[model samples]
Target: MASNIIHFEKDIEFSKKVVLNTSKKFPDPKFIFSETSWKLDQFQNLKTKLNFVKHKLNDFILEEWHEHTSKMNPSGLVVNHVRKHIHPDFLTQAWCKFYEIMCNSSLVSQKSLLTGNMCSVHLCEAPGAFISALNHFMALNHQSIKFDWLAMTLNPYHESNGHPDTVSDDRLIFSTIDKWEFGPDYTGDIFQPRYHEHLYETISKKFDNGASLVTADGSIDCSDDPGEQENIVMSLHNYEMMVALNIIQNGGSFVLKMFTIFECNTICRIYLLCCLFQSVEIQKPATSKSGNSEVYVVCKGYMGRSLATPYIQMFFKSKNHDNALLPLSQIPNNFIDELYNCSSYFCDLQIKTIEKNIITWNNKNESYKEINEIQRIICQEYVNRYKLKPIRWDQDVISSSNWSRARNNKRKINISYSEKLRRRDLCLQEEAVLLYQEIVNFSNSKTNECHEILWGRCDQVSLNISNVKYCLGKPVIQVRSSKFCNDSLLQYRIKIINKFPCIDSLSNSESRILYFKTKLNYSKNGINICDLTDTYAKNRNNNVILQYSCLFNILETLQQKSEDFLLIGYPLYTQIAVACFFVIASMFDTFAIIKPDRNFGHAFAFFGFKNLENWLNILSEVLKYILPRNDSYTRSKLALVSWLPIQQLVKQRSHLDIVLLNNLCIAYEVEPILLSFIQS
Candidate 1:
């Protein structure tokens, strides 16, 4: 009985905390007594006390809440179990997850900081993207943002920031609100309580410190008032034409829910924000349950003249609410990387940075790749000298041309070896096609197979490899920095990433292992595959030794290849997200920069980790410093790391040059030796 009483007291206390955070203390006591407010306190003093109680409520819920849940709804676990299936739009899903975790009280306490310093407003409006965020928050953690007079409120969701795209504007709930007599329902302005207290007080004050909403004529352009650069202010939705015309100092953010009404004015407002803000990205919150019209937010940085940040002289409220950016300039250059290198953009300080530096990109400049004959020669010499043999699982590599000829030769009745050779030669001249449809099916079929036909001028063949299914969706994007690919191997890697978000940040090491293990499992017979990194490193310093000992007597493969890489005709920077790296002819022989053991060491690391593991990490750092804010170098770095597959390298174990050889030896467990001379 005593425990029960204590539990009751705890519940009451938690209720108070929720009340305080969700609502604001109205300065006008008269407004609180109005019919709009009841049961909940107009001022949140009691609610503040309750939140302290609820801090402990978290522990209590974890320990005892489940018991209450089990009793309240027996078979509760199975009854509500369902998978949330989201299709495509991986970036939108990412943005939603960031908000869901950040905004929820259960997941993150108010006192702690969040990643990316991203911020959001529960736009006082209803049924829009803001509400969608709220619903997502509730669905993810089961904590609804219980509101003011929720039960008694009529047409409460009229101005919400969500709406199904298919629904015509005529059927909108607001359609009726604007035209008909809706009884004091529309009178509940979120800013009403504060308006009675202070007019000059910034919107931040009336923010309910939760989410605030405003309804303005959509005809006017929205902007923060530049005159009042005192404190940071943001509008979740921008039907308010005066938002941008009346903004606070740095670190202000605004999400404008707009139609394509004022194209010129909209462009001007956005352009100004881009100039003042650091990093800016246009996003559509696809995860929003409301699926409302497009939301374009213009976020700005805090504007306190700071020597630390001379660029904007911006100052943001620190975690402690003090003038935090005063010493921001004192931050070391090295530490600067950490601050800028984050995922979130809608937050406080970080948002300001992103807003100011936002770049509008129309095209990506492909990395310059001039054929280096010296590097090619060096790579060849290194490989030849190391003598590392590629895994010989297949009888021969299906060169770009031979795939069709082999198929045609098989079709001819008992064709002679010479005739087969002729067909194989002809296959090289044929146009590339996914011919598998003639003998196979495409999407929606039960199996994973490649079935298109690329009929060439000369040859025809079927790529009926069994491991195709596993290869079908390897990379959500292509791996290497290549232009185009017709190879089945290339196609598989490209499709894989395009399908799976989990593989987005995978490193070369991880992707390689995944490919090999998957292929090995699906292969007709289980084969003992060789470790590429180890093999290459083992014979790195001695190319000839590796080739002669580990490989069959296939002579002059490298020596005969053109010294000028320009002649080889390989594409540049093959889709880095897809696998398509080819050694050009121009690179000097024995010019391997990364050793196998170290560069492709684990074959199971994420892209981030792989870059950091190899010397490539240093190179990436350089690119980060050099590339513009919107450049695809970061993506390139990621793709480069994902391109190296464990099996691909292990199967093609080749020798490394001196630089790579030394690194490989050290990586593959070589001991350092000191040379000392003793005079006799």
Candidate 2:
């Protein structure tokens, strides 16, 4: 009664009779089962017989006798050897077998026979090793053919047993509801009979006719009792078969993963598949571990829907009755009864004994010790292959005491305030040059002909003023003192207003002369004005003309503030320069502010102009004047304000609408009058 002794005197005779009887029934002999034996002499002889018969039949099952022997002595070296070469997880072996069957069968060739493309569907597929296996097989064997695939499984976001069912590999890509290339929608819970209509509709929309290959690796939670486990697996198998039947096209193939063929429901499913397919064979590839009961039902050459409709209807109608069984009387074919008998005999003689041996092995303490040793060995090997050296944080440190002292002394010598100022200025100049180059390069890459005009103007400005340094030597504005209160501030403003001629009369030279005289008189306390005028006439070449109308508006506004403070000798020209820089910065800043809001459509359009060469050239001129100040905070603020608009605009447009508006304001010579509009 030992579990390892599967074929006793009476059972060996019965196994021989069942194999001979089943082999005789197949005319072409497509259906065949390799026999199992317990005795060493009988097992060796059976292997020799299988090799001889394998060449004759296209499909043949290989019985697993080695695992039964290892099960009797659970601490044997054979178990350790097998574990070392392959992953202990059974799914790895199952996927390997699935790949082998697909390649060896005509499924690959037949898939593209009707249509130019091959399409497949996977049901209840998650943690995706099956798909990974298929991908590997196609990559190695048929590299030229392209195929489409769709997959449906439980949503990983949904909670199951306090955790989501998620893939271990993060890199898998396929068709699903959230991430898909082929289908508009995905089918949910194909096991439910009510979900069948949705499933069919989804497949019809995704695949033109139907999928050429359908694979179901679906299973449910099993109880400790073998009978209860068998019942749950059988119920799940029914749902899996229903899906496979509905989706597969004519001449398509199906591979169903199932436990050993012991239960009556498993026999019924096999019989149904036999009636629907041209050939049906059960196979357990070498990659599948010998200890497990899992086997694949590889059904090939699907009969068309017209031929399968009646049988399918009867199967569905049986759901309402007790036991939900498809009556044996309804099957017109004689092969059903014969297949059932063969499957029953094979299970009783081979699988049941193996199952019992597995149970006996599971109860042993040595088996647990052997498994732990195998895992430890695997971990050690993995570490040897992939181990990396630890990073050394102090690698760059100077190890010699003398070298460290020398470096510290050198750093201290270079840390003076004046030296720091010089280095800081040098850094700022380098950054400004780099910024200018980046702007020019971006303009060259993205701008059009209209943008080039603005760039040309920028080039002109840089070339014309390259040698001219606008070093206004601290020209001052006098604030009116309460003690020396005079209406002279009002009188000076009126005098400037009268001298500032109409827009048409004020030529560039005339404007320059008027601004210089006003600045010269203000610095001299509005008294010794003739002396300053004479001095200005002597050094007229040193006075640079401020041409921008916005500059005049800023000067006038500053004059007003100076009068209110009653403070004199403020630097008028330097303030005007800073104000002009602010104007340019504000325009770009406004564009950045409006870019993300949908309601600011006009502002958004203005923000997108691509021709930034004019803007870049103008900014470069202003930065050249500001960089000498060596103020990091101001430089950083200016850089950020200037770069934001350019970055946003570079993606789309190439025209400078804002620049043209500023230019038109200057051309009209009405900057002071239009100061509100410019500021807005």
Candidate 3:
């Protein structure tokens, strides 16, 4: 046994030295000017090295090399052979290896034998190649086991600087030609513990006895330096194992893709997985290339959650620690540690030998240089075939030979400039003659109507109030009677007494009680008086009405008495109400106040005046105060009290119907009526 161990040690040392020597002859360039050139040079050197190793190896090993190289490109083989079944990519090979391990281990057969449905979870599954492979395998073999799948991957919606951080390839999903059979909501970075915690909670609720299978193909971006790249790859592998151990049920299986175990960190992770699993196997499937360092670690039959949870917790706690190895106490058994070390050592030796042999074979065969050149040429041809045409900025116009030929074939026709202008002038002359004839015909038809207006009954001196009332809707109530009806002051008054009674109507307690029944009836149909007044005031267009009113003079006088009255003394609503009153008063020939009982009164009484006599006293006082009240202004102002009030009073005594008022509020420029009511 001792001699056998020594022989194994010697073999490992020899393989390592061979690998080093093969790589050293073709040292990677410090700076590669073009990726194509670098790849071509590397390919030539690798082919030469591979050929050399073939001559040195035994017949069995050389046969395996021949089988692998005969395919030349496995991706091309996959595309051609199973082009309809699977996507031709590295992911397809990884998934094929995983499926073979599961099948060969009887995991799929056992699950099919069981009564319950099998649940599987896939981590970092974007482009969904593993899912397609699993679906294909299950469809072909284990039709008895109903499978439920959930997958987690980077969120395509996650943004960095307003652009998608990861964009999924839709072709991968569509290439399967089947509707997705898994839960699609599982998304986000798996490195985050919260994502794991969420999955744990979901599994606890939905899944019976946890998931039956967990597969992780997680990896991080690797650096060129082998040591740093190994560290990154191991860290990612450990994190994936940590999650798989936490979620996978007892008797469940886990398939992990990991690099060759060259570093202590990778070996340590494998040791931990071995401790928690009933069986562990490292496999490199035929689908995988002979030269690459990737291998799959298949762990089957988990040793129950009780045995794994504590180690899982410890892993999370010590994850931040710089040391890659777990504490001695964390190891479940001493035998696991020894077994893991032995297996890892063997794996490292095997990987080095394979890499060395590939390099030796490639270096020995000079024919590989021709193959490399051919590959570069084919690659360049493919690139050129698919490359997008660059934009051409030099050409201002697109030249079309077909269009030029068509234009050249057409017959030419031209006209003189003088002839074109003469034809246009002839058309204009014909239009002018037609227009003159139309005007003459229209004048002949309208002659009678024009004459009646020029010397009509409107010029007659016998036109009376009855004739004026017949012509206009309302009886003429002149400020000072003039010959023409148009000259008379027009007024409009909205009878809102029933709809909105004056505030002064509610002042006397006895009157309020007496009119309570009538007031209640009015309140039901009554619009808000303040809102109506405010709207009218806000929308008033004729500023001339306020400029000519006695109310403006009253406000100006009041403003002189107290400087801050506009700010503090007067409320805005009250000002709006007062402005509404003045705007209504100014537009009328005689401002009439129709009391609730159909009694005639002066308009001022509606503004809280005790009687007509009191209102007249205030009006006389206001007139005395306003200076330079000329004939026109004085007449216009007095017109507010002249005809309408007298007519109302006469109508009350005579028992006549009150005539409807005409258009009083003319649509013209007016100040905000509230501004007219702002007092001191």
Candidate 4:
């Protein structure tokens, strides 16, 4: 026991000596690529020379390290335990990290910055775990802060962004779309110089005094090139720092995610941060998986934007493609030595963990009892220390995106007549005028060469081949959501199918039947009109863009000169719905919006003799209006679609058709109408 104690003390002393040597050798830091070719070669040489040393394991046994951390880290274990019980949005590893930061650091609690208004900007923040955690933290600690936040991330639903590049899960974005800035192109890609400037302007406008807290958790999926992870993300890191520095207030705090900071860019970024902030510390939170080289650089007491300008101009702004920020010869020797020592220390720690995991993996008799005990004790301590309370996820609190779950519960709330009127009224005439102007502009604009011929038509369209009949053109091409499977929607479907027999089977080679049986998820009690309208208003552009993309894809497949489209359960007030009407009107001879279910939106049918030649010629030109552009926010096509007058759409109108559309619109209360309050 005495010998063991002595060894532990010796280990502590050795760690201290390593730190002391690093500090003594390099009192100030420098910018150099300490982790690339030079470091890899050095690591290989040391491994070969010290082959007998058990701690110097072959390669970094990352998988084993993951296993080790999962078993050992109490916070990680607690996260897994509570993940399912709590809302998915609030129970992420990232959530725990923010909570831990709040508990440990003065990022949020700094009294000087906690004035009347507190603002935070979350960059590359998707699935909004950080925001949720911060909300939870504020509720528990400082309820009077009047916190306002804005988040940006790669638009998950963006047609351009694919997997490994964007966060595809869009629950958070869908719920709180208004709070997010998708940049000019609606693709929140900060790596682009344009987005950076746009975001800077947006932050400046929103927060005059600058953000009190700015957190950037931006990272590229470098799984394919793990060895050069730091190098791969150097540009992104620089951009994140630039944005944070430019927008952060004098005493604001910035929390940035970094990994194995050995690259020249990484070193330069860190050195700059150290210079710009009063205190900067590297944190490897317990919530973060130990296998990966993930660390958060917590910077507090920013020395203001003026101090950051020189570094920004010298290193960040300059587009010199050199590997090092400055030549190694020019950098101070002490700084280089410090960088090397720090890098080596982290590398050693990683190697030792890997070696320990390897030993554990080999030893079949290794007991995890100690680990289990530690997890329990630490988890309790963590909860107590952080003062974490179970979050009550209410509608007004954290608007969860689990609409399906809400629908299942059948929860209803009483809303006032005025509120109902507000939710239901969509000014069509106003929207149409704007839409018409946009259409005119689009028609005049030059067509994109790429969309000239939509290459994939058959593959893109969901052709229904199972039930075929020669009646109109082909089998009904049915598009549906899982939400429509309920009995209520099923009845509506039956009524529609019975009324329009040709909808199931189309025999005329010149005609086609497109049926959309969509029933979007609503709350358990029923549709929350307020929630629905608010969401629609926020995502109007995106919805238009999405609809346009889909319509463009389908239009390519419309080989038939005349195509009939049936859109069910769509509120005609939406721009996408209006766009559908416009496209059908442009191609077909007749169009009608009919009521299917009063509870749901409306149904639309467009059928007539048509020729695709003219439509095909103008397809790209017409579609350009819906495409997300630099001027989407200012000259929004959605605004036009939302308030476009329904009357001006048709050249010839029948009383019966008007009554049908009016009834349909009134049934859903989706179109502009004044409600007269009569005594019940």
Best by lDDT: 4
Alpha-carbon RMSD, each predicted model? 29.3, 30.0, 35.0, 19.1
For residue 620, model 4's alpha carbon misses the true position, in angstroms, by: 11
Whole-model lDDT per candidate? 0.24, 0.39, 0.39, 0.51
The residue-by-residue lDDT of candidate 3 on 347-446, one tens digit each, is 4544465655455565546634424443333333322332312222222011222122111111121333333334345543353343334333433443
Q: Whose TM-score is greatest here? A: 4
Least accurate stretch of 10 residues (summed lDDT) in model 1? 671-680
lDDT of 2 by residue, 1-680 (tens): 53224223222321222211121121111111111111123323433433233222212112222443443422233234434553222224445556556654556646565346677877776645566456545544554666677776643221111011223121232222332221111113444343444556777898887878888887664422333444557766777787668878888888888865444455556766776787677765433443344567777888876655554555554434225244333333455446545545434444443554555444656655434444344334322332212212232111222221111101112233333345445543353343334334433433232121121121111122232233211111211110111122222222333333222222233343344334323243321101122222232222222222223333343333221111111111222232233333333312211110111011111111133345445544544443223223222111111112211221122123323222221222222312222233
Better of 1 and 3 by TM-score: 3
The stretch of ten residues in a row with the least summed lDDT in candidate 4 is: 671-680
Candidates' TM-scores? 0.20, 0.40, 0.40, 0.58
Name the weakest run of 10 consecutive residues (lDDT summed) in model 2: 593-602
**Candidates ranked by lDDT:** 4, 2, 3, 1
Model 1 C-alpha lDDT per residue in residues 83-117, reported as the tens digit of each score = 12221111132234233222322322221122212
Give the candidate order by descending TM-score: 4, 3, 2, 1
lDDT of 4 by residue, 1-680 (tens): 74465345333322311221111111122233222223334434433322334323334344554555566443446686556444434567788877777677768736434476778899989778898888777766776777889998876433334345655445566567678887755557775445656777898899887889999998897644455667788778777888788888888899998877465556556666766777777766655654456777888888888866655555445555345554444435555566566656555555554455566655523535544554555555556666666655551235554432222311122343333335345454443343334333432332221121111121222212222111111101121111112222222322233332211111221121112122221113211111122222233334444445455544554544434544343433222344344544545555544433323334444455367564454444445544433444334222112112222222223322432343333222321111111110
